[model samples]
Target: MSEQRADVIGLGMIGGGVAVSLARRGRVPVVYDIRPDAADHLAGVPAPLASPAEVARASDVVLVAVVDADQARTVLSGEQGLLSGARPGLVVVLLSTVAVPVVRELAETCAKAGVELLDCGVTPGDKAAENGLVAILGGAESTVERATPVLADFAKRVVHCGPLGAGMATKIARNVITYGTWRAVHEASTLAEAAGVDPAKLLTVIDAADPEGATLLSWQRMRLAGKPETRAMVPQVERLLDKDLAAAQDLAGRVGVAVPLVDVARKHGKETLEIRVREDA
Candidate 1:
């Protein structure tokens, strides 16, 4: 791993981490962010600074990890975007958890430009990615093969999810479950407290249900444990659930499915959305 092979573009946390990993793997990643200080933060680091367009032009392997599908479009189609800088047979990996429509739209755009657009979202959190143990899903055999070394530089396991956009789809679905489950726990615990059932005891009991419950539940327990230092979420439980519920609802509507429990939790979550995001953000 040296600096010669380091050439990628990133714009998100995952993107930042990937760029750093690629640098460690001998790749000099071209990094940028809309934030004014994005470049200065990484200045002089192995990861070099460049505008989104410049990176896209210089990068043979472009990784888009924007916050949402909208940002993805802006990065690839905006003035001086990826398409302008991309060469033939370029590998454009969409590593964001975005809507299926976003993936398809971006796919069409990349196809028109003759670049191979692969929806390759990854999960496994920051620690896993840092250790190269993240899971990658999407792309075809040849496409996956071509991208394997780059992926391996940041992931321990990579699975091609059949066709294009599969990675994006898988990530969206996974988030819907995870965020929905998080909201469910918050709402349930809130209800329990309102009913005079000490939610503390309930969380303790739930944490023991290993086969059925999950580490997610354990996280909820930690947040709602009544210990002021760790009970940060208690004040804004309603809001956290609200944002995730909205995300889940958005996902459900996209899939043309109805999630009743999710709807109920969201209805309860909205009560806290404004106060929480404002403070947290």
Candidate 2:
């Protein structure tokens, strides 16, 4: 690697991890966090900086992994933000999970200042600094190429999602799956425990049954192929889902347990799918 450094502006879970990973690879990243203790963990590994502007001044690619959209803006445009010292050719990668519009607006701001900004959403959280997370990138191809070296140091998989906000959009969609699955599993465990089955055992069975993950992937692939094709699979799939949901609802009612999401799924699942497929198509 060149003497030019990669910097991190946030030392939270994701940022801290990435800093450690970069230092482990001998990158010797310059990192800064609002919380003094957050950077304490990186001690000798990263060259700790006092502010985002200093980090931007010291590095070639600056990774912004702050909290939310507001924090992201603060770290990038606030008094001591990265933009204060950012220059042309500085690639600022946003790893925080914010809305698509925020990413686009930031990209424009970066452009106005002659800085290159890429929305690079990361998954697997803190473990990413060690086990390597997946990087979902959105920006011009040349910019993505320029950011590859830094990304490769901490990411196991790098996907160029599309222009500007696409990476954030994709990440938000993934968040939906993450939280929605959590809710579904919670309800499943509740129902299973109520019906005399061990929730852990149910999870084991589920894992065993879908070891390849094709169950969900198949639906995703179908939708990706377009609505006409997805529409064809819906009739049969919806029938099975409707029947199963009806039975599950009956079981829940008999056991005096409420599965409201299940009921909602039963009532609007197909419609939701139809709307999404059509809209995205």
Candidate 3:
């Protein structure tokens, strides 16, 4: 119905979801994927075009959701790739989670073809069809504005992080927080299980004490805010962290459970908490 035509390349979970979401909003995108049957898996999505180039030819904006950097490169530059059919002013929004370097490399390729590239990092792949994804984007402001309407069809919230590779960079950093916290929770669960406590109960206690998990980011928030009062409290917080981590290590030793995360946390207590000791102190 809208004048702006959009297409999708790749029909995997994320891509299929994007197509479905767009269709639900009355913007059934021209779709492409390597597998001939990819469209059958999605409702309201048309069958795949023969190649990425065909999809490009029919689209003003194309969202590429391939699995990795190599596939993305192929989709954009290989024979029958999108660039072969891309018209001037065509915008390609890459939704893959490749490295920052890879994003920049692909952006260069897109630029030479007179196509604009936006590195878009989407989260919670399972929610892609529900129009619940948060699109973390990086590109020139004008390019971002041009693609926002198509992007809005699938993403519930769109954050323009900065230029070029910033979206992928932010995604990588966010993944660190996600997986790092999982590792920390794994260690905690191990300790609790070794000490004859149910891991579920531990989770219950954690949820009850910090329902929103505010404590997880409190230290970083304080450090970032950099108020004099928060800075003054860092040393005390560092001491408390060291003491608690030491106790966890000791408890784990007694229980014969490995607390490697706790060990590392203790080792980097001051650094982790952003506490810098003054020379005079």
Winning candidate number (lDDT): 3
Give the poorly placed runs of model 1, Cα more than 4 Å off.
1-6, 39-48, 211-281
Cα error, residue 180 of model 2, in Å, equals 0.5
Candidate 2 TM-score, true structure as reference: 0.87
**Clash totals in order:** 8, 0, 0
Residue range 1-281, candidate 3, lDDT tens digits:
45789899999999999999999999989999999999997989999999999999999999999999999999999999999999988999999999899998998999998999999999989999999999999999999998999889999999999999998988888999999999999999999999999999999999999999999998887666666677688778888999999999999999999888889889988787774443343
Q: Could you tell which candidate, 1 or 3, scores higher by TM-score?
A: 3
TM-score of 3: 0.94
Candidate 2: count of backbone clashes, pairs at least 3 residues apart or interchain:
0
Positional deviation of residue 229's Cα in model 3 after best superposition, in angstroms: 1.5
Candidate 3 residue runs with Cα over 4 Å from true position: 275-281
For candidate 3, the clash count comes to: 0
Query: Could you tell which candidate, 1 or 2, scores higher by lDDT?
Result: 2
For model 2, how does the per-residue alpha-carbon lDDT over 142-259 read when each residue is reduced to its tens digit? 9999889889888989999999888888898999988988998899899999999989999899899998767766766666667766687777888898999999999999888889
